[model samples]
Target: MTAPMISFEFFPPKTAEGLAKLRETRKQLALLNPKFFSVTFGAGGSTRDRTLETVLEIQSEGHEAAPHISGVSSSGEEIQGLLETYRNKGINRLVVLRGDLPSGEVSAGDFHYANELVSFIRQTTGDWFHIEVAAYPEFHPEARSPSADLMHFKNKIDAGANTAITQYFYNPDAYFRFMDQCQSAGINVPIVPGVMPIYNITQLARFSDVCGADIPRWLRLRLQDYGDDLASLRAFGLDVVTELCQKLLAGGAPGLHFYTLNQAGIISTIASHLNLQGD
Candidate 1:
């Protein structure tokens, strides 16, 4: 079998110190030779400038950069301008999303959904970008039903997204079942599994709650038992996540997209454990 493609996601840091640390982290991850390094757009386009700056710098470092763009709080003119800027800067990849609504925001601006954003990009930039949209193996939290969530995902794929990256999920069964559903629905685009290397149960619980990813009851209890013993927790988390990746790949996942949380230690270890080094 061919080696699976791998990618890493990062958020733009707000502080000078944080940015410096992220730069170092990227340097370490770069050795893994990911397909690209993606920088996230904050909720409602909050980190627009920082994201742009970070991606441009990554490009300068000679690595492919995929900057994310969220459509919920942005206007057509604004989105158009950003696309033009990235095209000019030679950034040819993007992760599109229906961004979180800014606290107390009433309108969804020009594009209300991620499918709209994908469609807009195609209209404005044609085939200039390789677009990736969000997918939810466990169903989106706000989705009214499973069928509705599948319909929404199909809409994004139909709107011109080249591929998708799923929300981080611990259960490989959930991913395989979602893939089966996508196949039945005739959605053929590559849908990469997102992996989150867990280090802290509390933080993982908070994220899982918001994103609708299920942490199996047994796994949660085991993690909780680790309590303040970070060393034991991390070791166990590493084993769990590494096994998860193995199962997904063995089951024919297209690739893996890691939610690195801007730290290299655990991610690096996981990649090594998976033998994800480039050929």
Candidate 2:
């Protein structure tokens, strides 16, 4: 069997200790030979500098680093400047996103949606970078309907996105259905499945709620049974993610993108389980 391709997602650190942890996480996971890795941008462009810094650091360590860019937070000039900076650093991949509105405020129109950003990037960069866009297996929360959401998704690809990384999900069927819909819509780009291993049930629940990802009752019940036992929780979490991956591959997913949560152990375990260890 062909080895399953993998990538990871990380966030910029907020403190000195957090920065140390981020570096350690990168070092440990880099040994797994991920196809690429991404550093998330903060809401309202709060972590713009740090996001670039982290992306460059990952490249410096000889790994592919794809920085996330929020079109809703950046102007055309700002977006060009960021692209130029990454080009100067020899980084040529980006995960373009239509970021959520800032807390307690409305959008001020830097960008209204990701398709607009995709068009802007293509017009500015002209294939200078490999661009990836976000997909919603359960449909975007802001979308009017699933069909409308998918139409918008297809629009992004037409605008010049080369690949799509889905929102993290537990249900493999959701992903398969999404793939089928994309195929029917004529969006032929790779739709990489985003996998999130539940490190903490409460934390996962909160994130799932915000991101519109459903947490199945079976998994929730298992977490509730494990209660506060970290060791058991982690073991079960690994098993769950492993099974999810297996099902995804069995259903024909091209690759897996892990939300590493700035930690190495869970991702490393999953990679090993998939037999994707580095040389």
Candidate 3:
């Protein structure tokens, strides 16, 4: 059997302690030999410097670092400058996004959606970078409709996105249906499923709400049965994610991208189930 291609997403750290934790997380996950790793950008490019530093560190440690960029946070020139900085630092991949609006605020300006960011990256970099765009199996909260959301996705691909990494979902059917729609809409690029093992039910629920990923009643009931048993909860979460990965692989997913949440144990457990191990 062919080995599955795996990648991880991490957020930039904000303090000395957080940076140490981030580095430790990187070190642990790096043992799995991921295809690449991504660092998320904060709202309005707030974590710009930290994101760059983390990417550079990952590259220094012999890993591909794909930095996230938000079109809404930057003008063309500013975006160009950021790309140039990454290029100089030997980074050649980006996760282009139309990031969430800041709290208690409205619009950010310049670019409103991901397609514009894709277009801008292609125009500015000329195919020197591998660009990844976000996809929604359950639909984005701001999207007009499922069809409209897919139309926007197709626009991003047409603009030069090489792949679409979907938001995490509990149901494999949702991903399968989304892929069918993507194919019908002429998106032939790889659409990797993003998997987030539910560590904390409440926190995951909040995030799912923001990303429009539905938590099935069955899953909620299962977690509720575990109550305050941390060890049992962790085991159950790993098993659930592992089962999800197996189903996706069986259904022909190209690869898996983990939202690691700056931790490695859960991802390691899932990878073990997938028959992938650190060398």
TM-score of each: 0.98, 0.96, 0.96
Clashing pairs in 2: none
Model 1: CA > 4 A from native: none
Q: TM-score: which is higher, 1 or 3?
A: 1
- Backbone clashes, candidate 3: 0
Whose lDDT is greatest here? Answer: 1
Ten-residue region with minimum lDDT total, candidate 3: 270-279
Model 2 vs. true fold: TM:
0.96
Q: Which clashing pairs does model 3 show?
A: none
Whichever of 1 and 2 has more lDDT, that candidate is 1
lDDT of 1 by residue, 107-135 (tens): 88899899999999999899999999999
Instruction: Report residue 38 deviation for candidate 3 (angstroms).
Output: 0.2
Q: Give the alpha carbon lDDT tens digit for every residue of 159-230 in model 3.
A: 999998999999999999999999888889999999998897878889988888988999988887888897
Query: Per-residue lDDT for 159-212 in model 2, tens only?
Result: 999999999988899999999999999999999999998798889999988998
Extract clashing residue pairs from model 1.
Answer: none
